[model samples]
Target chain A: MKNLFISAALVVSALSVSSCKKDDKDTTPTETTGTVELNMAHRWGMGADNFLLNMELVHPMTQDTMTFTTFKYYVSNIKFKKADGSWYVHPESYFLVDLATAGSEILSIPNVPTGEYTDMEYTMGVDSLRNVSGAQSGALAVANNMFWSWNSGYIMVKAEGTSPNSGSGSFAFHLGGFMGSNNVVTVKTVNFAGNSLTVTGGHTSEVHMTVNPAKLWHSSASLATTSSLMMPGATAKTMATDFYGGIAFDHIHE
Target chain B: MVVSLLITSTNNNHSPLFDRGDFFQNMRTILFIVAISAFLFSCKKAEIENYKEWGFEKPSHFPEPHYKFENNTQTYDRFDLGRELFYDPILSLDSTISCAKCHAQTHGFADHNVNFSLGVNNTVGKRNSPALSNLAWYPNFMWDGGINHIETFSFAPITNPLEMHETMTNVVAKLNASAHYKEKFKKAYGSETVTDQKLLKALAQFMAMMISAESKYDNYVLGKTTFTSAEENGLQLFKTHCASCHTEPLTSSFGFANNGLDSDFTNDLGRGLVTQDPNDNGKFRIPSLRNVALTYPYMHDGRFFTLNQVLDHYSNGIVQSSTLATSLGTGFNFTTQEKQDLITFLNTLTDQNYLANPFLSEKKK
Candidate 1:
């Protein structure tokens, strides 16, 4: 009995010592920090007055007089390619660009990781996953007026108003689709002139891009023939294709 | 040395008696609890299984579904939470009526023998309570085809004063008041405070997971069995006459069509209310025929009480209209045997498996 008691005591003493040691080990100090930001800017084609939707502009190519009053589209999934060749994607990233709002036109994303970024990438329209998923919040919120109440999809891009050639007084185009032939989600990439952006020791930088609205009508037939588009169809396809193709990397500001 | 020895002896004498065995046991228990807590917390991150993942499960012969599960990834937890909220009456104005009230599982999640369903305060709805199944495969919702996206679909029913009679703000407030709902919201969406966004997401999660691909017709298509001669002939007739508007697999094309309901607008403009175009004067969304046997009387106004009347309208009662479907330009002519056969074919869409599926039923806990 005495031997058994001694053995029990030793085991108890060992457990106590080991548990305390573990408790001390768990409290070890460490620091982990990273920064990421989304920088955005807007640019118009040659001799365009600050880019407003539906403002009458004489097309250089077709020489047709068209007045556009509304131009808006969704931009989401901002990401940066690191020097290590991996991408750091921003979560729940969505943006609505109304050419009317100057602030919205220049999207600034802050808190990006301090690293050397080789390239920047962004989506032109809402992803397919967000389209089918039910009600959303933040930039994708229904209150934003970008969402269609009756038809269950985001108006990824809305361009409306009237043209002189068209007989009708108005033209409205709400373009959006996330599946099959109508899927218009485009991913764009920008390499900093073969030079990497060095973000080190908590520094801020800007990635500038030039987006031209004129390209929206490149492949889309003249405004006189098809002046309005409200739903996903052949017209939406032509306009979306032309507009998405027009997005190019002008230069990096920082 | 003399002073240190004296101090040590005094300290030891004043201290209480200590047992190494008891001290270690307490430490071990505490350490074990901390370890378990850490493990559980780390496992709390949301995953694909957190939402009910429903893919297309239609039979081979059926056409590809319109609702392709596009952006909404399926998961188990999201579906479970959606199902819970669907049956819970906390979403209504008075906390009395729920979606399941009008749409019960026994009647293919439709109403109980009523053409127009009763909403909050016993108010009557404008249209009939259509069956709720195979919704994920539907391109459009409602009789007018007003709503476009599946995510924004719940707003119409929730905000319709004659329906739930509750705003999203009020529903979120009610959900936030209950500790049970808070707990559930945290489990499903990683938060305790319930918002309209989360509520809508959860509800959609439940509604979208409702797949109604299992039926007699589905079985026959899968080669599990063969259809009766009457059902087979009816299927052929449907392929020729009805399938254009009703479509297949999901049994609806989700487009606006005027089935010659009237030669002119009488009361409701249906799809015209949205477009405001004179051309869309009398169009309405084509209703799915998945559970047509149970979800009657037919049409947006519930005008027909029986299948024979509906067939009659298609056969000889088509009124001429500018926006009428081109298929019904003249009108179909069917005999007595053909009508009976079409009815039999409609019966083949009744999904007994879906009606009795325990997963869709009220969860006990």
Candidate 2:
């Protein structure tokens, strides 16, 4: 029993030594770290109404009647700007925010060092590096049906639904391109606006960000015009930019 | 025969039996793990003691591999699992087409003279199915070089509409549903729940082992055999004319080249579709000339059925294009004797041992 206890202690120490070398190293073990949840409160355009699947709604911009069956996109490379002027960069940070999956909208950043953060930054879609890196696990796994197989790259933003405006009676917008001329991968930043987040130990801070799905057709045409986009191009870039650009940081709960 | 002797001599101690000797030496340290395994009732000891026997090892002549087995480490269980998956039709939507259907071992891992391989539900594919060997050494995969990694290569065929026409989610679900696959996955990765990464990594494990370095040319390179006068002259002529893009040792630099296959780029843009660069419009992957004799109907579209026809194309049939490879300058205009000699040299690249290796073949149920 004594030897077992000693062995268990040894195992714990070994695990600590190994985990210290892991890629998800934003803070050291000794540092007092706090968790931050970027609660993606999905909303519609213009009036910012409730955005839920299976619910029929008219697009504020395109005015196209649509009922979404699936809406999923990638959020990756989360970072926090420290008050002292440095950045707390999280490593291997990737999340698939799917409307159907429970708790997927909450982008959780754990083990963030306790500090006053003035800004939060994240890539709207997956980075080009992870897209070309091959088979991945967790939120970036191919099993999630987010990654494109034929032409390599993540399907950065996918919005599929049954629409009356569609010729096929259904629409699927799979937007992604991490290459030259057509790259839609853009890094977005949200300023606290002097309402800085106090990330303290033992308390989980939540940041509510309103995501307008209707903005996908803001600059682009209605579903009646271009019903589907399977691959990335100018149309994919325009629609993705509109939706990603319109995302606003609503509020924060300390 | 000499190739197997050299490889065995170099890696004789990599057998699983060697681990047993290390086991007794480190028994005191790993006693806790053993006790825990006993408590869990899963004795992994029965799992092949050595997968390192089939671990990725570069040929003495070849350059360093591009895929250094980054995440998916070499293991027998993984290779076996991959082999099963490679030959299994469950990857297709209706379970009709397997990877082996297109890439067969007897034909140097290429289809048997089929220009375009038939896929699931009698769907004919677009591009000619290319031969696969020494894949670990390849920088990129497919004729277009679109797939950047070998681990992700299987995904393209599985999800392609004209190919397997299956979703990754559905494939994973199918794998999880199979008790045989679940057991295989458990033995390979210690997990009953099979994920796409595991599925891909397992396939890569089998593919990475598809090294074809036992050909007569390899033997000649290793100083184990001699080439005839025609083969020797052909080798020198090849070095002077074709060795720039179709480089030595691996027989390919794995670079993209518009080998003057076509003048117009309206139908298939080839590499341009992936890069979105019009300059790369007609360029396709300059394929390895290894096993060129068996991998016919040749070229990206299987345009040439015979080696002589391919030679004639390179010598007399090169079309003019902006993206044409600067290396291929208006046909070689090879003499009849020179063409015969070159074909003879190409025939020496057929690795019969690699083609007939029992380990790579599908396990009979």
Candidate 3:
């Protein structure tokens, strides 16, 4: 028991040291630059309930009983606007926001020169360039299973779940199209509601966003009518537009 | 992980190397030994593996390749790993079919005497497996040119239910599970973890080395050999009739064309499905005709089994369509003698060296 206590104390010390290292990383920002984190707080429809996976929920619009098994989407090409009309573009800004994967909602934007940022610009789906750039790593890796093999394009947004109201007893919607008239990739700008986020050195500022997953069916039919949409077309574009449009910048916690 | 060990050894920690003092010193010695052995093991492995030094060389006759092996730099080991992966059936869901099942080495890396190659469970595919050669020169892949990257080409077939019937995740998992594959991947990519990107890049490396440039026609172009009268006549005929689409040297411009295949394209929209343009209906990529004699069963659908049938289609069997190649007006009026001469010219394009390249063949267990 005494040895066990000692070992436990060692583990606790190690954990605390590791956590302190992370705290240092976040707090002790470089003199010239600071980190800005975009926290995507996922929510349901008009009721504003927490949107989570593997939990039974009723669709606000479709009135269909649904349980999402997987909900993954791509958010990329982050850009921040300065007070002087100049924008700081993040290079290689790509992220796969998976509901099942913890902490994926936080998009960390690093190496921003300390300044007053007026607006946040980000892409809802992967950029057209990355979709055509072939095999990628990190969030865009093929292992993520977010790419269409035969047709050659990334699945911009995917929502797989089970629903009792569906004709097939399951729902799978993969929305993506990066080329031509049917392209579903949208570049959305969040102007912080006319407010400015002041970023100073040795600090981390956050832009909290509200992403409504239920907005996909805001303008579409119920699960019984259309349970699955696996490819790109008019239906995918509509669903993507609805979902992407629902994502709004609520406020900034500086 | 290996990187950390390397950094530790290269650091200022040498007192324990020559000491047998305590557990800490012993731990340091073990780490040093492990790092040294790892370095020596890799060196020994490389020394034992008798592979030709790899550098993607575009043939002097051919123009600069479209994919000049950027992003996917090739070494001999990477090519070797790719060759193994290509021949291994592990890419298939059931381990019953491999890329080599459809793309045989002897048949210019196309299916062997079959229009549609069998996949897992003997399920057949729709389109013919096009011969893979000089792929480093191809800017786009597949019949419809939907795939634009060489690194991502294998994903199409590996995941196609009518082909390998495997998911990229499962394939990577299976590769990661196997000790042989893990070691191969480690030797090739510096990590035991097998990823889709690494797998695809390795395959691309092997493809970059598949240079088919030593044919009789290539010799003729180089002024090393003189073509027969029939070959010369056939070359002239090909230039006049087919050069606009199936351009010279590479024998393809890599553009899409309807080619008068059909009037109605409801079954297969071809390039139209990718672009969503009605004008591109029934249009397929203009395939390279390198080793045309060996790569029989021509066209995207493998409708023609022989060069004669292909020639016949060009001569008389032109199915008129709104999206048909405007260059291919009605049909050509080639006689039997001219067809024979064209066949001779195509036969001269069969590079014997490319077919029997020992480096590309499967490594025996």
lDDT of 1 by residue, A1-254 (tens): 99999999999999999999988875653212234434344435555435556556766555557667777888899888888898778777898877677677666565566677888888998998887666788778665557655556677888777777665866677887666776777887778657776654444565556666767777666677777777665667777877877776655544
Please compute DockQ, using alpha carbons, for every candidate against the native two-chain complex.
0.26, 0.56, 0.51
Give the per-residue lDDT of model 2 (tens digit) for B115-163. 9999888888888899999999887889888888888889999999899
Best by TM-score: 2
Model 2 DockQ vs. reference: 0.56
Worst 10 residues of 2 chain B by lDDT: B42-51
Between candidates 1 and 2, name the one with more favorable DockQ: 2
Give the per-residue lDDT of model 3 (tens digit) for B93-135. 9998988888888989988577888888889888889998998
Best by DockQ: 2
Candidate 3 stretches with Cα past 4 Å from truth are: A1-34, A54-67, A81-89, A110-116, A162-169, A193-195, A198-204, A221-226, B1-54
Q: How does each model score on lDDT?
A: 0.75, 0.88, 0.87
Off by over 4 Å in 1: A1-108, A112-133, A142-148, A153-254, B1-73, B189-197, B272-279
State the lDDT of candidate 3 residue by residue for A191-238, as single tens digits: 864689878886799999999999999999999999998878889999
The estimated TM-scores of all candidates read 0.59, 0.83, 0.82
Cα displacement (angstroms), candidate 2, residue B168, comes to: 2.0
DockQ of 3: 0.51
Comparing 1 and 2 by TM-score, which wins? 2
